[model samples]
Target: MFNKWINEPKYFNKEKETIIIESDAKTDFFVAPASDYLAHNAPIYAFDVQGDFTLECKVRPDFKAYYDAGAMMFYVDEKAWIKFAFESTDIGHPAVVSVVTDGASDDANGEKVDSPSIWMKLSKKDKVIGLYFSHDALEWRMVRLFQFDVKNLDKASVGLEAQSPAGLGCKVAFSDIKYTDKAVEDMRKGI
Candidate 1:
């Protein structure tokens, strides 16, 4: 795992390498900072990104409240970021969720998976960003694709994120964390 930035989690065990966060009341990372009500702060365990890179993690989320999720995020700031997660639903089922905030948060919901543990991967090549998820490590599926405006930013932040948008807090275990300085050979292939 890469080193975590100053925005660390609430409770972290260095020996076990476990992270636990107590969600701040009404906290999330969204845009429309001027007038929109969706913006709330969450702990972002960030690491700097370079030219082209790929990062993956296996996350098992304990969904205690609505919208609590384990996420992998790429953030330029509050105004621009990509959050790909498995979010807890009100219907008692979890769904694959991806929210790209480029001024405004475009929250998109993907196919629901039955498993509590999910695998997520994100890659960036120049300005284009790709999001993907997998049931098993062998096969990966695309979640969404978009062009992030920032390019050649030597220190763009990317890392694990946990948020409980509507409730108190949640538990998220992120293991088998993998980070590589090189970009995926082909973004379309999702290698």
Candidate 2:
């Protein structure tokens, strides 16, 4: 999955330096911030694992500003999608965890932490989708869960994304991105 998206750098390129998936142990894409909104318009593709699925990755922002955003995204099309990201407020403000769905933005709902290495986990069951974040890998706190209509869920491709609209560059790394089906017994528990 990484190879397919990694090879198509043109589709994910921003106004700054183009991103490339390196051959070493570090699996990340480096992008310079866009002065215009052209970078924000590109959609990150992912294969849909809609039922009881979990997607998680680590992100580090390269700058300190309001729109220095980075996170894993599930895009249903160019216009319909959700992204849970962390954005800093200049250099002195606390970094916020935010969610954008259908082009509307929401405030952060998790606890406060410093320059924290964060992980976002998004799970879907039926029409409801749940978002969670973890400071440590073991425990997860719910951020927000809302309902959305993703037109074509089964054909979607999942991947990570980062954009700095403040004309500064940020690098985001994604690893351990896996999609799996819920166990039959686990599904039966709901009934």
Candidate 3:
């Protein structure tokens, strides 16, 4: 049900039950407001889903360079999208980072995680979307909650994304992927 969008990855394999994507060198999806530079070359394996839903996955990135991330993406178009990522931050650690892109992207870094992997959840209820991350996939902490106002926000593609913005490349493994055609009742608790 998933297909590649934009740039093709160096390696993509889904036969092992765990999805693995090796992002190519300098692959990313960002529109910087400071320099007004747009980069939308990252590979995304996504499928269109209608109505409100919850998408969850465990992302483990081979964090080799700064800004390298394995993300759960909510995509609308090149100019509008959300990247809820497990990223190797510039602060010398892996952290939860969310980027809400509407023409220009706004980046926010959340909780710092010491683990090799983390579980990410993206829930959509009408025009509002919530992002959450968990250490053990049971207790989740909110990363972002905002309205993604667009023409067809309810009918968008949700998927897995990998980017290596600064390094040559990195492999990202996505496992325990789950999807439900319902919204989370509580946005604050993310359960």
Strongest candidate by TM-score: 3
Give the lDDT of residue 30 in candidate 1: 59
lDDT minimum window of 10 residues, candidate 2: 20-29
Model 1 accuracy (lDDT, Cα):
0.75
TM-score of each: 0.87, 0.65, 0.96
**What are the per-residue Cα lDDT tens digits for candidate 2 across 31-111?**
222232223342243454445565665555554444555667666655455667665555454454545445343344345
In candidate 2, stretches whose alpha carbon ends up further than 4 angstroms from where it belongs are 3-39, 42-52, 90-96, 103-111, 176-178, 183-191
Among all windows of 10 consecutive residues in model 3, the one with the lowest summed lDDT is: 1-10
Candidates 2 and 3 compared by TM-score, better number:
3
C-alpha lDDT of candidate 2 relative to the true structure: 0.50
Clashes of each: 3, 7, 0
Q: Local error of candidate 2 at 104, Å?
A: 5.2
Candidate 1 lowest-lDDT run of ten: 6-15
Of the pair 2 and 3, which is ahead by lDDT? Answer: 3
Which candidate should be chosen as best, given lDDT against the real structure? 3
The C-alpha RMSD in Å for every predicted model, in order, reads 2.5, 7.9, 1.2
**Model 1: per-residue Cα lDDT over 1-191, one tens digit each:** 45764354555443355554444544466564356566647777777877888988787878888888888888776566788888886667898888887778877778888998888889888888888888886688888777878533566789787778787776678876788977677687568
